[model samples]
Target: MEGFLIRAVVVGIGLWLASQIVPGVEFRSTESLIAAALLLGIVNAFVRPVLIILTLPIALVTLGFFLLVINGLMIELVAWFLKGFVVAGFWPAFFAAIVVGLTSWVMSGWIGGPPKGRIDVVTMRQTGPGRWE
Candidate 1:
């Protein structure tokens, strides 16, 4: 779907930004960057929710900071799955996650999509006697 492709592109940009900003994160080529972005989305969609639910107690106890670790773990998992992507260690992955997250957040706002729960309204005024436009 169009929406998925848009998301993937946004995520790809984020990943590219991360690779530039985070020292230990690297992508061998554009294709690998694209693959990593798509796979990251898929991992977040399917694996992250389960991890969150299973670790709810720890997440609550840690005041939700554990989610950052989970994010790093997801990046590491993606690196493990893709030969062309490399994350040197947990610290780099953690910092890379932060960069990617911020990039995605900022880019999504600028990209001009219909955001969730947004509403549009139209109003009309009478132009002449018994006429409205």
Candidate 2:
């Protein structure tokens, strides 16, 4: 999907920034960097949602701040599966996750207004004298 690839590239940019700024996170090669980007996107897409649902109560209790932990966990999980992609500890992952998440969000917003690549629109029709649809 075009959306998927676009997301991956955005995340790859974040990953590159994380590698430079986050001390404990590193990519031994460009291949590893790219692969980690793709894997991170996959983990966030599939695994993060289930984790969020399971931790919904805590997330609500924390006023949504706990989602940062979920984001960190997703980064760590990606690191677990990918060689050369290292998250030294929970803190490092947590901060790097913040960087990655913010980077992706800002980049996506700049690329278009949203990640979907299209703006939303609505149409209104008059069905009757005083009714609308």
Candidate 3:
């Protein structure tokens, strides 16, 4: 769908930004960068949920801070399967995750714009004195 492609592109931009901002995150080639972005989307869609469920207790005890670790793990997972997408260590992945998440959030708002064909409004008419229809 169109939404999915837009999200993927946003993620790609985020990954690119991460590589630039995070010292230890690197992509050897553009193709690898693109692939890593798409793969990260896929991993987040599928693997992340399961991991969240499995780590619920730890995540709760940590007051959701462990979600950051989960995000870093996802980045590391992508790096493991992806050639030329190098994450130097857990710290690098953690920082990269933060960068990518922030980039995606900002870009999504700019690129996505307002929602299409939808509006939030309320209207009311007086029927009988203070009684509304």
Candidate 4:
């Protein structure tokens, strides 16, 4: 879907930004960078929900801070599978996760524009004969 592709690109940009900002995160090539984004999307889509469910109690107990741990764990999983992508350790992955989230949020908001919640006064009808119209 269009939305998914946009999100992948945002995540990819976030990955690149994280690599630049965090010394511990590294990608050997552009191919691996793209692969990381796609893999990260797949992991977030399929694996994250199950992990969240299994670790719900711990996540709740940690007042949702453990979600950051889960995010870093996802990065570790990515590193384990991808040959060129490397997350140095838990802290680096954690920082990368933060970067990814912030980048995605800002990029998506900017690209997608404002939310569809505002009233459009120009589109209102004035065809009625009543005084209220």
Candidate 5:
């Protein structure tokens, strides 16, 4: 679908920015960047949830801050799965994951395919009466 491809491209750009901002996060070329994006998505979909569940106690204890470690581990896992992408060590992967998350957040704000300035909310009251209240 077009939406999926657009999200992939956004994620790829996030990965590219991560490589630029974080040392030891390296990609060989655009091809590798695309590959990394795919792998990252797959890894996030399949592995991240499991890891999050397993680390729930730590995450809860840290007020969800430990999600950053899980994110870094997912980045490292993607690098391990892909040949042309390399993450030198844990610290680099941690910082790279932070950059990737931040980039994706900013890009999503700009590129989200929603009607401009529209807000969707659910209310208990019906449309006509008491709607404003």
Candidate 6:
């Protein structure tokens, strides 16, 4: 779908930004960066939820902070599987994940997807209990 490709491109940009900003995160080329983004998306979609459930107790104990560790680990896992992507250590992955998440959040706004920027608007409606009309 068009939406999916847009999200992937946004994620690729995020990965590129992460590689630039995080000292120990590296992508061999633009192709690798895009592939890393796709791999990250697949890992997040398929593996992250299982990992979260397995680590639920730790997540609860840490007030959800453990999720950040999980995110970094996912990035490391992707780097492990992808030859051209390299993450030097946990800290680098952690920082890179944060940058990637931030970039994705910002870019999602322009992409018109579920993660788009939120705006609240108030409207007046004629009284018809529990109805807009």
* TM-score top scorer: 2
Q: Considering every candidate listed, which one attains the maximal lDDT?
A: 1
Candidate 1 lDDT tens digits, 1-133 = 7877888888889889989988999999999999999999899989999999999999999999999899999999999999999999999999988888888888788987645885879899999999999
Q: Tally clashing residue pairs in candidate 4.
A: 0
Q: What would the per-residue lDDT of candidate 6 be over residues 1-133, giving only the tens digit for each residue?
A: 6666777788788888888989999989878888888888889889999999999999999999899899999999999999999999999999988988888888876655665577999887978878784
Query: How much is 102 displaced in model 3, in angstroms?
Result: 0.6
Q: How close is every model to the real structure, measured as TM-score?
A: 0.83, 0.85, 0.82, 0.82, 0.82, 0.80
Which residues of candidate 6, in runs, are more than 4 Å off?
115-133
Off by over 4 Å in 4: 113-133
Q: Which ten-residue region of model 1 has the weakest summed lDDT? A: 111-120
Sort all candidates by lDDT, best to worst: 1, 4, 3, 2, 6, 5
Q: What value does the lDDT take at residue 28 in candidate 5?
A: 88
In model 5, what are the clashing residue pairs, if there are any?
A: none
Clashing pairs in 1: none
Show model 2 residue runs off by greater than 4 Å.
Answer: 113-133
- Of 3 and 6, the candidate ranking higher by TM-score: 3
lDDT (CA) per prediction = 0.91, 0.89, 0.90, 0.90, 0.87, 0.88
lDDT of 3 at 51: 100
lDDT string for model 2 (1-133, tens) is 7888888999999988987999999888999889998888888889999999999999999999999999989889988999888889999899888898899889977897343566879999999999999
RMSD of 3: 3.1
> Candidate 3, which segments miss by more than 4 Å at Cα?
113-133
> What lDDT tens digits, residue by residue, belong to model 3 across residues 1-133?
6776777788888889988988999999999998998899899999999999999999999999999999999999999999889999999999988988888878867777436786868998889978996
